[model samples]
Target chain A: MIDLQEMILEKDRLIPLLRKLKKESRLIAPVTNKHGDTLLSEINNIDRDTIDLDRQPQNSLKSFFLPQQEILAHYSVDTTGYNFTAPEAAKETIYFGVRSCDLTALLYMDLIFSKPAKDASYYDRRNRSVIITLGCNDPFANCFCEATNSGPYLDYGYDLQFIDLGSSYYVAAGRRKGADLLNKWDYFFRTVEEEDQKIRYQLFLEARGRFNRNIQVSHACHKLQEEEVAETIWEKLAGRCYDCGGCAYVCPTCTCFSVDDMAIDDSHGTRIRSWDACTSSGFTRMAGNHNPTDRTRHALKQRFLHKLKYDYQKHGKASCTGCGRCVDICFGGVDITTFIEMFTRDAS
Target chain B: MNTNFIPATAVIREIIRENDTISTFRLELINKRVPFSFRSGQFCMLSVPHCGEAAISISSAPNALPLFDLSIRNAGELTNAMHQMKAGEQVGIRGPFGTPFPMADFANSDMLFVAGGIGLAPLKSVIDHCLFQSGLEADAVANITLLYGSRSPSEVAFTTAISSWKEQGIDCRLTVDAGDDSWHANVGLVTELLQKELITKNTKSLICGPPVMIRFVIARLTEMGCASHDIFTTLERHMKCGMGTCGHCHLDGKLVCVDGPVFSLEQLQTMDVMELGT
Candidate 1:
């Protein structure tokens, strides 16, 4: 058993601890490119890589775990017989600067994939990885993580959590891996002084007040549970949505996928699983030309309800992390923030 | 890769031409050592290498071990490919997934089986199970009525089995929307047959068919003193992974693949929304 511990790391020792971690494990951290876009990617050269601690990355941590497409099995069919082979195991990696919202999204995803039936590939990848989350001091313009209770600051659900404390960093261990990380770099992390603890509390309060958006998502969540939102709101959102599925692709908790077999030769093939979205018409259409949720309005309603109401009822929490990526990436402005406003606008 | 998404190989033992558009493929697992079993109303993801996969309901009862049946209609790309394939051909199968019809709960109750067109495919397994595999003498149960309907006389499926069904003490009643030169049975909608029969207090209706027919049958049943919970039906949705991981078959809070292809009217009533051919 590991006890929760908090420590202080001086600004000058930060790079040294990261350099030490890079020696044993593949490192994935937030970095800003020449285009000024922040992304979470694998970094080999720790000295040259510009790790961005200030901004949330352009994508969630799910892509590194559950990729866009992956081979489930390889198959060969001939006149005599057929055979199947499962894919090889994944590598060990540590995600270094995950945001609180994205970390919360991962927690929700873990529950979904593991429940009812164990998702072998997802669990395999998830088990081999470690996550280090960074609390938000400066939220983005569209962020509403506070409304969803998924961040500004997350007290649990990561291997390690980092909070900026002016000249040094305040680090807390959330899991055994985090404790191990602190022990590995004992020379860098000093015992948490009283002053450091005071600053940590002050900074957390400051971060909570810094959020730009104040959307009341929980209010909408309750309203959605009681009754349906007006059909006109769905129609309006559907009119703008091109069914591009960008929102789901950017959503860390949306884990829907499709599987298919691609033949390499007459006797050989590979079964592939790829990301899929409910926004598409083909998602619910049966082979017999029957579609229960045929209209775009119904599809849009299904998506939002799943995020806001249905998941909450099933899992005891809403699946949306309010990461604001859907707002940033969606061309149609059909983000969760917009839906919440519309849903609660007429609530009694 | 996930093993749940990987399909096992199954060979087509035989094919029964049910109609112009539908065929029943009798399939057996290539590796007989891998024991597979399924109850009525469950479905599987059938795959044709290089083509794709579709969720096809099982048409054979669970007692028919070592071999199962999938009644498919040549409606889409993957299914059309399935229809073109011949016996001894190999295909990928991943399942025995989804909720099965509540056989134990409805065992002592009177069963009213309603099927329309190819909808009879899934219900056929339940009929076979109750009539043949229930370990009870024929007519030992309270009641068993089968009211099946098709577009026309020529389009009817399982024509040869209707007489055998009658011999087995199953009250098999057939209807068609239109009549032909050689036709001499009930000539009207399947719901019209309901008026000629008596519904008992403990009758459990097992219905499957076109959305329109199901909607009307449900409405008629509800009007005639049947509780919403006693009326059961199967819902069809697009599916990739038959397990709950895939979101294609999700309907609000329910993942149709796992939560149901089989649902009671009471269960649907509690859902956020479900299409009823409106």
Candidate 2:
């Protein structure tokens, strides 16, 4: 049998293939809503609604696994005694048209939740889902995933990676699930011709040259380890921060969260966890109104350092995936790229 | 999503009101699977009914388990709900997490514990453990000294524990910020009491309390020729998940949940620690 590791799917057959896949499992893809913003959402009507993979989806795939807010457990203090039941198991899902940077961020989330012990809720959703990444053929204006080693095209980490080649698509399978899909649906794919490999390589080279920003990500990571950022630099960033929390919320790798119990009534409650940002005033505030970190000057200090220095030391790579969403979201021009530029700039 | 945050059930065996605002909850794990054993500085996420969890240190010695004590101050929502909790009621527990104090290194060393307010709860664990080991082990602590402080005489907690430690031939010095009519002990900062103590080469100073108290006491100890490596302390921070996922306890490059709640002064040397003001 021929090894079908890579194949070509005609652009005309993409919709028909997705329709077949949607019948068995829940299908999620990028869709432009009524407000004209494209987000990765579930397709209720595969035939009617147009799937929009042309734009950079403003949101990442973080919420699907580690949701913005989720119920961790349900508890009750009744006559039967206090007890808790873990949330139910997750349904099998097929995530199509996922950007390469977002899938990379999900992989980072997998590592964070696994250590100490695997977070039960996050893994339930993550393990049951299949990831099909849509590699960027043309990097966006703010995109710098090249520096972060995540995208405009990735070498690995996707179950299936699909690259656009004008009239058709070049699909490469990296994992077992992806390889299984190609064998199951062999009718929709063609054997890789010699011309397909040449075109894929040609497009990959063009995508690398298209990145507009050359962020010194590794330089900043190394510089932070050797020397401290000036106090004046911290003050400059913190001064512009309005505490909107948009940067952390938009960040795919900003996996920090807060756990609390929400009461339904007197005896019943649910323990929940919600996404929390280090930039907020209340992130580190303890009981008795005792806040250790002075937010006036040190608000953005821990966040940048944790992303650049701490995670780099632990994981051998910085956590900032350079999706450039934070670069676009921050109105104050105080995104991580700004910090890296300022910190790595040579000072005589 | 019955997730991992589900805490095992615990029954409140007793509640001793330490002061107007502080109480010691004596708890026993009612769950069968939780093989609970912890070191002195490790903390547990205490969950009360209708209220969320809070990271509180385990106060009693491990020899006291399966019964342990969680000394709390009525400073916030969860702790206030905890103060209203009755004995025989049930609460939830998540941990026995964090890097515990270096008990292996404590053998044959002179142990000096300095505490303030509710901070004495964690140090009491190490102190009582040392006392218990003296009954069985040959290389037990050489001696134990306690310098505890409170805001006022009425605000003083752990009076019964202090009396017991004093009766057992341990040197326990009590200090208060303000003097009352019946107050006759040292009426100054806890640092003043530390001033009279002799710091030798083998003394291991373990400190816990408010941030300001820790700063001043460490300064005094360092001036008295105590090496930074020989001095150890546990740092407190806002905590959520006890398993290092939550970002509340981020200190410098370390997560207090993982890297430490307990660290030597040398380990904290160049780190930006809130407790030591480094």
Candidate 3:
């Protein structure tokens, strides 16, 4: 077995460490509000209790890599001539206190942007940043990460995993970057004992048992490829689908986008590239009366199959990380866990 | 710093009016600092100030002159403004983006070209390259056949050039959906021209047209013994960016702007065909 070590962070010291990390790079962490919910926001001042790593954020981690709106190119047109210019690259950022499920979602996104035809824009951001995951002590009711091969603990993607052990937190380095970070702040952490490591693993196991929901689909991509599921099933499930595209909007793995042209001046225009979801009616509409996926049922089916099947066939893993943000955000009560269960059960 | 973007200026050299509805513009780089090389059947994002931007395929062969050709149909706002542009006008051009037609994969196999209306624009690039290379070395290319169909005889693009190719003993066939008194050619849907005997064995095909026409032609080709992998088609999606960043051109997980505007039927099958929310 690999020798494991932990760096303890007392509740009082958490804020100081965050403030120190902020000095070097931008630190984004979860903050709660009067609504009793939390959101990931850039932290200028760190209050340890304000950071809630228990629940997944309402929005996806995708906005960190692929923003909702980005200026792609700027153009200037005049009596003299027209000039075109491309957009600038992103800055260095450290996404702190990210949930394990969201970090797994980032792994799927890496597949989309790191394929043979790599996306330079995504590569720029991915290369410039470090992922700091916080292990979930209390998973939400909607979460089913265990069913999808993800859990409360960090697997391969995260640079660091912070496991809360009551009075103090145990920090485990998952990557060289994490080790280097720990090395920089060696004074802040005392050497961990053998007993502390055992307790951390037990706490993680207890947290995993807390998750109530589970996905039933086994080998999700292969089931989708079989073509056994008919149109009626998709239509039936889609009856409740609102076509809001909230699922995709909140999914870290959904990489659909749309290009926009903004007029900067009479002689020039700025072309903006932004995220777009396939769940919208206008997603596949062409100029003269051609829409390959014109029906809502078809679009809904496409979203799920793309996440569970098409992406897997191309990237070797399911795009979904069972983050369950889609489940909680959907107004129509369209839960992917239920869908997977019904589809896989019927197939079996 | 501005990263992940390249801006290039192109000057309009020539414009060919293909009917009252559509026209093709030829553009050459003004900077001339970098040599722009693009495969046939690849598209670029063409931008006009204030009006908008559209994804247009480079209809000129790389082996040809430095100029690139963009065929515009006066169907949308950008094309409407583009139709009024003069030869000296300048436009913004980005990319030669997306995967090009598999020319190397089809080498040594007999080739068939079927195009309809403005769809002929993309196919023209591949045809030009084949013809140019074949003229230099006849044995290097397979037997080339062109079947071009348009709404009417007056709408046929490259009429003069096509006729010249025909005079040079290139197997060029023309058809019209409806013909006039002046028209002396076959009148029918393009699919009707795809009689089984017309398709040679061990042949590859390139098709581009209206979605319905493409679907019908593909069905006919499959019936006539052409494998899905042997046939290539160019798809036009609502693309805002020529790069894969925009989600507008996505069919399932595949972004048409990046993963393809050119896809064999086999690749397209992996996408979910149902409409959203059923």
Indicate which candidate wins on TM-score. Answer: 2
Model 2 per-residue lDDT tens digits across residues A18-112: 99999989999999888989999999998877689899889999989889998899889899788888777888999999999999999899999
Query: How high is the CA lDDT of each candidate model?
Result: 0.85, 0.90, 0.76
For candidate 2, the per-residue lDDT at A192 reads 84
The DockQ value obtained for model 2 is 0.78
Q: Model 2 shows how many backbone clashes?
A: 3
Ranking, TM-score, top scorer first? 2, 1, 3
Docking class of 3: medium
DockQ (Cα-based) per candidate? 0.67, 0.78, 0.49
Cα deviation in Å at residue A216, candidate 3?
A: 1.7
Model 1: per-residue Cα lDDT at residue A221: 82
lDDT of 3 by residue, A46-86 (tens): 75437766666777578888788777667777776777665
Top-scoring candidate (lDDT): 2
The iRMS of the candidates, in order, is: 1.8, 1.3, 3.3
Off by over 4 Å in 2: A1-4, A346-348, B1-3
